[model samples]
Target chain A: MTCKEAFQEISKYLDGELSEELKRALHEHVGRCAHCKVVFDTTVKTIELYCDGKLFPMPENIRNRLHDLLRRKFHERAV
Target chain B: MHYTSMMALEVNRLEKGTDRLTGKSMSAQPQKATERAESELIAEAKAGNGDAFEELVNRYERRIYRLALRLVGNTQDAEDVLQETFLKAFEHLPDFREDSRFYTWIVRIAVNEGLMKLRKRKSDRSEPIEDAVDDQGQVMPREFRDWKPNPEQLLSQEEMERVLLDAAHKLPASLRTVFMLRDVEELSTGETAEALGLTPGAVKARLFRARFQLREELSKVFKSEKSLDL
Candidate 1:
């Protein structure tokens, strides 16, 4: 596969959603191409980071406060 | 089908165990009570019940807050957005269409409110918002970098978190919202498209671009920190 074709399929390849034929082709391309390999690796790692939920942690206090506010608003409306 | 049947069997086993422990034939009493309570709450809340609304808020507060925080990238802005979202939902409760799930509808409102705040902030700043980093690297688009050896590895966990948050904030309001909804909130593409008023394809494209840009920015930050340690 050409570099452009491979680049476009990188996301699908990392997602493991690519067709076997395309996956094999892309794997071949990455094996021979340093630049494409880097791009592929970066994309995969980024997705993993986000999926792992390591990037952000919502503070417990903030969550509690928002809950309280919502509850208060609900009660006021009830009255 | 298999999984569902397995789950059913497990539930049946548990029910049998509970019945044996109680020394009586339990007749799904707890399930019926819970169902009744749920229906009553929904009915009362629909009848302009403020207390019911409060109960609903209590149930979903953590999720809503986290959604706001991820979208806004700041504690204060997130809090403001969260309050506004609940207030608007309360005011419009009577008009709510029952066709959609309440949680989904509320989430849509919260997302819109968050986007509005982001738009206002962008306009106030008067800086041209470049959502993605083009090949030129002039505006420094957010994209992931290829993982390299951690040379210095001096960045603390807090520092890395701050960098990630900063990168997210730098994303253009539109792209950033998509990223937050899709990646952070784990909303489906269809749901995200509905929330943002974009087509599913558009949402996917924006998300792909946003992820690319964020990874790039994060890599730059990590690389620079490594250099500074030298």
Candidate 2:
């Protein structure tokens, strides 16, 4: 498969939604093509880091403030 | 004595059968009880029970805040958006049709409110779209920009994460929303499309482009970092 075609299919491949035939074709292409392999590796890594939940942490202060705000709002509405 | 003994045996049989039925009934009770409690809480909140509303908020605060933060790109803006979202949801609680998940409905409200804030800022700044358009209003083609060689070759994972976040911040708001919703939040493409009022195909196209751009940015950063270490 050409680089263009490989790029288009990479997302589906990462999603594990690729058909077996297309997956085999892409695997074969990546095995032989250095450029396609790099793209595939980078794409997969990016998705992994994104899904692993390592990106951000909600601050404790923010959580507390939100809870307090909710309490206050609730009390105001009560009155 | 024989008659009394026969009557006692009959009573024991009935007791055993009732125990079996009660055991089965008890086994099903917790699930039904939880559902009933949820429904009651929702009813009370809708009826203006402030404590019930607070309980709902407590249950979902972290998820809601994270969503707002991801969409708004900053803590302060996220907090503001969260406040506005809950206030609005509370005000409109009576109008909620109950056909959608409460979380989904609140998320929809937060997304809209956050996007509105971004749009307002975008208008005020008058920032030109990257890759200026030509006379035909089509985006001008540009050369592929890659990261420089021989920069910092190796960065810690934390540094790499920082770079990724920076690159994500550079994405246009529309693309960023789709990326965060679909990639970060792991919402299905159809759900993202429904939330954003776009067709599923359009969501796919945008997501693909978003991923492409993000990949380019991240690879550039990694390449530059690798080069610097050398």
Interface Cα RMSD per model, in Å? Answer: 12.5, 20.8
| Model 2 lDDT per residue over B120-200, tens place | 777777532232322123221121333443222355656655666677767676776777677655566777887888888
Clashes of each: 12, 12
Kindly list the per-residue Cα lDDT of model 1 for residues A16-51, writing each as its tens digit: 457868866877876666566556655544544443
- Model 1, C-alpha of B178: deviation from truth (Å): 1.3
lDDT (10s digit) by residue, model 1, range B58-144: 655566766777677787888888888888887887787766656667789998888777777876775224445542233222332
N/CA/C clash count, model 2: 12
The TM-scores of all predictions, comma-separated, are 0.70, 0.72
**Cα distance off (Å), candidate 1, residue B69:** 2.5
lDDT of each: 0.62, 0.63
